[model samples]
Target: MTTPSGPTVPFALARFATDAGSVPGLVVGDRIRPLSPAELGAPSLNEFLAAGEAAWDRIAALAAVASDASHSDGTTADAAWRPLEAVTLLAPVEPRQVLQTGANYRTHVIDLVAAGRAKDDPRPIEELREWAAELMDRRAREGIPYFFIGLPACVVGAEEVLELPDYSEQHDWELELAVVIGSPAFRVSREDAMAHVAGYTIVNDITTRDLVFRQDMKDIGTDWYRAKNAPGFLPTGPFLVPARHIADPGDLRLTLTLNGETMQDATTGDLLFDIPALIAAASETMPLLPGDLLLTGSPAGNGIAHGRLLRDGDVMVGTIEGLGSQVVRAAAARVPA
Candidate 1:
């Protein structure tokens, strides 16, 4: 119900995770200080997000000061706040529901179908486009929007392990730009959608392609969370760059690295649905809360299309130009056989 305010924050910002050791960080006045657990005092980003706009503004102000001082002389002070590593990167917002879109990117759709990763179902595409156009128009008039959900437990932060489950051999990685809701939004208009966004982060919507398509064909209930929620399946975050800091979400660069090789690279402009549409579609179902996260679909070059599955010890990295990035490692799940 609260009107969203601008971030009023700058880049070169990050919330330190208290649980991660070695809190050493670059201080406000261009000084690098080793942070002991006691010296590190900021709550987790998830906590700060829950604190609402007033607290967000304060946090933004402090980050802005530090960001400004870091680049005081035109030299970029690029230091990763160790504290971010300590906290388990929860979903940007703790939304009661999480919604993701399908075929939101043209290339993602075309490439998947061409590679036999997705079915050549023109009917679904036609329905979705019409649905999207209608939703877009509806959002222009009213404040309510449509959106979807991802499983809550399907989230993991930077440097975390993505354990590929033993049930399937079709694990895939999707590089997506995730939007975190800052304020309460219900039936929110597109003009107001961005206002409700607190910031942006990176998400790897890891999935089991074979399982998903097979389930989709049966007309049964969705198997999305089941295939996507394997332990450590959702690798997110190294930082959450407040929305104000980003000049334009559409203009940002998105890239993903598997092991040391770069696999996917694109931008938000390539999104078929875009952020505003996704927001509108989502708000139609439920009120997007402070911590709700909306993941814009990924770009071309997924592992599935190329037949490359992750192995133990593979490192995965995802980055969005202004929003910082995340690094996740992969390994076999440790289960008692």
Candidate 2:
């Protein structure tokens, strides 16, 4: 299919339907061009990304040539060009490891702390704000990024339905920018971190609020596994935009709407620890492998902060500046009698 004359996006790697089944494809405008078996070499997106930087460069070059040819021909229809809507969009890549940052956004942390303190303190809002600001400042200066492991079994496609666990009532949404690793990283410095990133994708880190803290074992602290690792808890990807396409990861906007009402709207600029810092911190303990995902923490205005948690039949639309949007439906978890 011929494309319109404009700035051609090199490629937006995606997995879509083909005659044999779903395969990795390169997205150009509204159509998808399935990667041939030879081109794929690797069976899955995970393996494809792990094939190294030269592999991605080759794909991008091939995509650029096709895009240029399409522009020159100006043809609108081709058998190879399938409309994006017609194909099933799967999670761009199945990461071997999923690591999520906790309390990485300044405003998100401030809001939670302020709300918790408001229950006991008689101070005014301004006073609380002042105290919270000081606390965050100190944390930024002294604290390192806190990260937790996430199970890859919980990941689902962009349009997948999320079954709210029956054990929890306060299901919530946490829209975040998920970083995709291109190369292995071990105890890497912040200066060399960007080189390891393949691209960016959106991940809605759905959490069950009531399950976050272990009531019976307070000393153990948060139980992210139970609260977050439910099947389909992570709705990820419509596209994995190449890191080169995004000018600055720290400057993108993130927003989420529940049933058409905007809930969380913030920018990566508010992040207390940016991508490079988060990468460095996470790699300090373990190696970050190719196709691994690092979820930068969500911004403020989550269900806990707004008192409007997710409910069955709710539709959440999460959007990040250049990464694209994800629409997921909430369903009641079925329990066997």
Candidate 3:
């Protein structure tokens, strides 16, 4: 196996549905080199990822070969490679465990706090923002990332639609950068965290605003189990860009548009707790197995902050720099006739 020629020659990992079954592939430009059972030892990314970083290194090397061959003579003798457009793109990884860091973005938390202020409050927007900024700084200095578990069943590929549950009109969108874990992590230090990461992908954590908190149990706090666990709620991936390709995860830009209008425009620089911090903190209590996901929180500019929740027929297009784009359509859950 050969290593990637250089970081400039980009490569992504993806999954596609074939007549035989689901197949994981190496993405080079517009073409794909599908993996065989002998290549990765499994048909699923989750299982293959369990083989760990060496497996990933081998794949990257193969991608480099494919990348060079694709540009060199315009044709390769290997029949395994196919056009990306000819296949259906599935979620890049089948995470055995999915954990999300909540309110990790400095500005997003501040915006939510400011927006929640009562209309009768005498404080001006400038004062509120200053106070929020200080609060965020304090959190970053003294606090660790807040994490919550998510059901894997809620995950769906980019080809799926976001079926807005009829139970709540307060449906909202939160586009985020997701970490795909490779090496096992257990009580690892912050400095060693990145070594465990396999790559990154995009996930839109849809929520039912009304179901986020229980009316009768105010002291018990947020009900994330109900608020964020809807089927098709977590629409993920056109592809997964291995960590080697991303120059710096913290320097990437995130953009999401609702029905062709920009709703979220921010950068990873706004994150209060970086990826390493999140991984280190989360793995402290539990063993993070291969192919598990750790989602960095969303940046500012969600539906509730703008008072413009998702609606039927609304198309949500989310893109994170170098991670590819996701186009998810929201619609009212149809009742059976």
Instruction: Mark the regions of model 1 whose C-alpha exceeds 4 Å error after superposition.
Output: 1-9, 12-56, 64-96, 117-148, 215-217
lDDT of 2 at 247: 91
lDDT of 2: 0.83
Relative to the true structure, candidate 2 reaches a TM of 0.91
Model 2 CA deviation exceeding 4 Å by range: 1-9, 17-21, 41-44, 71-78
Evaluated against the true structure, the overall lDDT of model 3 is 0.83
Q: Local error of candidate 3 at 230, Å?
A: 0.5
RMSD of candidate 3 to true structure, Å: 4.4
* Cα shift from native, residue 336, model 3 (Å): 7.5
Assess every candidate by TM-score: 0.73, 0.91, 0.92
What is the C-alpha lDDT profile of model 3 across 67-135, one tens digit per residue?
666646555666887877678777878888899888889889888888778799889988998998998
lDDT of 1 by residue, 1-337 (tens): 1111112224323333345542323223222223333322344434445555575566545556556655446344544433332344433334445567666665656666556523555556556555555554454455432234577667655556677777777788898888887667798877877878777777888987767744436767446656676766667654556676677887778788887688998877766666877787788777878767787777888998678977777777777786555777777778831
Backbone clashes (count) for model 1? 27
Minimum summed lDDT over a 10-residue window in model 3 is located at: 1-10
Which lDDT values do the candidates have, in the order given?
A: 0.62, 0.83, 0.83
Candidate 2, which ten residues in sequence have the lowest lDDT sum?
1-10
